[model samples]
Target: MASALCCRARSVSSPILSSARIRRRLPLVGAFCVISLGLSNLCPSLSFKTGCAQSLPFVPLFKSKFSSQSQAKSSGSIRMASESNTVPSIVVYVTVPNKEEGKKLAESLVREKLAACVNRVPGIESVYQWQGEVQTDAEELLIIKTRESLLEALKEHVKANHPYDVPEVIALPITGGSTAYLEWLKNSTRD
Candidate 1:
């Protein structure tokens, strides 16, 4: 059945199977295979035969470095969450009108312990709609790094100190980074 499907896929020689078209569709095919494999594991009835993925050259098969328990135990570089005691870190962005306000806000955030570090990036242009009208303004961007636990306090502080009525304050999680830098960020911010 798997070979039949593979043959069918190869035999389809329409214009849609051209080089560029194949490139565009390969990702979708790979995603479908991944989802199919996951579903097959969850429901035994949907399982594909062992060589199904191998038959399709365009579909990528990914193997993790720690595929076996022995390999995982032997590796010293990879530490489990329970072992690391790591805290989640976040990077918050805030845009201000000018350099003066950006500098003031960055200093205040660091001084108040609301953020570990605030980087002031100048010469940014912002265009958005406000009060049913289009508006454009020159702005500076502030990148604040702190613990995820301090997000609410950080937002409140920015709201109070920012010059704009509706300040652009957005936070993005720092998924992974250098352990030393993450530790510094965690220690620098207030609990």
Candidate 2:
């Protein structure tokens, strides 16, 4: 059962990594995931289903339908496992006054290779103080995904293209993700 669980945890149906290849390529991650899975069963409260089961090691246990971490967190999307290591990815969160502007910025980032992917979520209501005045507005959120090294460049690009005098550009490190997806992320963005 433990071996099967490990196999399942690392399973990614890619042409490059068949089940056998995954096990061979990531033996340690697979073993670690299997151990974690066993422990989770022992302690039901230890479950945090972060979509692709980053807790387990060989690879992602599964994938999530949603791509944006901020949106997913806001919606209580999934409960992921807890043992996964932080990957070298960063998620940049930016807010725009409207969806159209958000779309433009998102497209620009991806097109410029500053971001691997950008998820724009509309209808988000934001309330904050700006220039000593309380402000409220319906806003759009842009979740940008890319390698951590691109943060500086991404920030510069956003500052240049963003319409707001001070747009919210926050980033959180990607602690865990599917091995294949992370590889894709690395491949998609500039070094």
Candidate 3:
């Protein structure tokens, strides 16, 4: 029975499969595995990729959306929330005509956890056209520091509480800045 397995041998044991044999056999196995992975990526039909499936190269069949840098940037400005250093993250510049009202609103936002903190700079002179009327007034400016994610909620809360029929709640993206400060902002504004 042992003699049939060997070309010629008495007490000599056979070496492992040759490198050429391994190379020839592996491609077939690799092809089978690739097909299996590809099949799992396709669902509902051959043409439609499921929500779980994405088109990327030289990576695993599945990867997280957060792992995709392009998606992260396009969704919103990506701030590296580095908690290691001391820096201030995104600070929204808020303008309101009344100092007292502005301070009140800022405090409310911070107390409600919509904002990490708010600082009021009183006595800002502003001139703008409202309802086709050019007007000038002494306005208070609020510097609000918080995470990028909470911008929407902050806007809504500000508008709801602000005295003006239309409030100035704008988010200017922080492209690059101190990483440590950004991290603090991210940490402070969590659900």
- Kindly give the number of clashing pairs for every candidate: 0, 8, 2
Task: Please rank every candidate by TM-score, starting with the best.
Answer: 1, 2, 3
Q: Model 2: C-alpha RMSD to truth?
A: 18.0
lDDT (Cα, tens digit) per residue for candidate 3, span 64-174: 443464445544433443334433346787888787788788888888777777889987898889999998989999989886777788888888887788887777766
lDDT by residue for model 1 (98-151), tens: 999999999999999989999989999999999999999999999999989999
Pick by lDDT: 1 or 3, better one: 1
Candidate 1 lDDT trough over 10 residues, lowest sum: 58-67
What is the lDDT of every predicted structure here?
0.77, 0.74, 0.65
Q: Compute the lDDT of residue 43 as modeled in candidate 1.
A: 45
After superposition, the stretches of candidate 1 with alpha carbons farther than 4 Å from their true spots are 1-85
lDDT of 2 by residue, 13-131 (tens): 66665666655657777677666565444443555454555434643433223333444553342223122222378899999989789989999998988888999898999999988
In candidate 1, which residue pairs get closer than 3 Å at backbone N, Cα or C atoms, i.e. clash? none
Model 2 global lDDT (CA atoms, 0 to 1): 0.74
Clashing pairs in 2: 48-79, 48-80, 48-81, 49-79, 49-80, 50-79, 50-80, 86-175
The global Cα lDDT (0 to 1) of model 3 is 0.65
